[model samples]
Target: MPFQHPETTGHGYVIERYVTRKDSDHPRYLELNGAHVLRPGWPHAKRFARHLIDDATTITDAELEALLAYEWRSRLTAAWLIGVDRRESFRERIGDLLLASEVCYSGGGFCFALARFGTHADAEILTAYLDHYLPRTDLHYDQPDALGALLHLDARLGTHHADRITEPDGLWDEWVKGVGRLGHPSHTPAELRRWTDLHCDFINDWSRS
Candidate 1:
């Protein structure tokens, strides 16, 4: 039996189950970004966006924001997947996708999604995030996803916006140190090693929660 979240529609298994199942029987689905799962199989991105907006009641404000951010990430991933398959439709969506990518919050998930897209627009969004969010002491910087996104965005976008990234204070340094281990395609081996060491600790803490 599939485990279910109360929040799930129960029309099918939740995304976690869907993704794990995709790894085996449905490799093509694997290529579909987890972010895209926000819309499932919708033919049009705008339709997908509408679905999300309609389903807004099912999720909290933070989760809705995360999903919006994830949706943009998924669009980029979909573009890449379509490009790999030589699909002409992918080209048509690129501009719209770039615009959608800007809707996400400046967290690691958002950043990772941007890095995955790796477009000029993605770089601009990442730069804007660093400028608007990092300077605020009231905002939490401890989330690994946010740090990972920043690190990956930095690696992909380079030092063009480096001056904007303030030094990590509070748990920000620890957060970056943790994400360094996850070893995204965007990171160097040295960066990966450092991140992995920190990430392991982070994971251990997360497991306890």
Candidate 2:
């Protein structure tokens, strides 16, 4: 089902399509009489995304989306939208592309994004990414974000380690394991403790009222 946001007009439709977004606008966007137009500034990525959102009914539209896979933005857009369609092919392709990206870098916000449509294999892919790069990361947010993704996916799988959530080191041990869990190699114990607290603060209300 589409996510309901009663606060906004068009509700879930607004999140489904990227039309009203000013954040992703190309810097070179054209304006005429206060109207937004232009082929380049308004990218095909958004249009293809619309097709996915509006439920494309034609083979040609699907064909075009397949061709548009050349862009990472499209892949990211599709990765998020695939949950609505639940197309296994879309999941496989998006998951594969996302996995490739994750291998090169740590899972930050992208991990949470991937976790939204996360399947079992996607969880494994993310787990591999976090298990490898998270320990090696110096980025302050990498550990929490990576762990958040795993936790999010695990929540669905009934395997979440939220039991250990109150314990700072317990959270870290799952990802880094052994010596690095306490933040010696990449961070300090104080820092890990702060992250653990923040994680609880978020998870406490993540799916709660």
Candidate 3:
């Protein structure tokens, strides 16, 4: 299902305003314009990752949903909170956003949240995104992270949903061919690991502290 933005008129607009304002002080709020926490700059968001986890636990679902309707920053923040809280209800909506690829940067959050959900339904959603987007060789959205999420899901659920995608001369082939033209590597295991760990760090590492 496509993600429908609530009519941004009276109350909807207020919701948007509320979330946007709420996301302002997030540690990596400014980084929402580009790739999220797992970019080249190691530890950029690490010091404050725990604080965000603390915030995620307390934020209400209504606010998180409203944040999803706002800018990438708000959407990313909402995704993290939803994941930390394990709010599985938002899985479909986050998958919708991943497929829409409507905005930049937020796809990481969407993918991460779906992975954290760790269910077959979540895997299906990730598969759906790959089915639709991977063939579009000219585009570079969240395909890598989506693939990584599927991999994680497969490992958790004991399913091979991502096998064909990562298979030889398959959709993964198309993705590599497309990204190669742009001088980017065909695979980014390090980035994928970082993305996967970012969520784990929030859930485990922070809890220990």
Show where candidate 2 strays beyond 4 Å.
1-52, 55-68, 102-118, 139-146, 161-167, 170-209
lDDT of all predictions: 0.36, 0.41, 0.72
**TM-score for each candidate, following the candidate numbering:** 0.34, 0.43, 0.78
lDDT of 1 by residue, 32-133 (tens): 333332333434434333332233224333332222224333333333333222333233233333333343332333333444454555556545544554
- Candidate 1: C-alpha lDDT: 0.36
Q: Which pairs clash inside model 2?
A: none
Pick by TM-score: 1 or 2, better one:
2
lDDT of 3 by residue, 74-163 (tens): 787688678767899887788778888888888988888888888999999989998998888888888888888888778778999988
Model 2: per-residue Cα lDDT at residue 193: 33
Between candidates 1 and 3, name the one with more favorable lDDT. 3
Report how far residue 73 has shifted in candidate 3, in Å. Answer: 1.3
Alpha-carbon runs more than 4 Å astray in model 3: 1-26, 31-47, 188-194
Better of 1 and 2 by lDDT: 2
**Where in model 1 is the C-alpha error above 4 Å?**
1-107, 141-151, 167-209
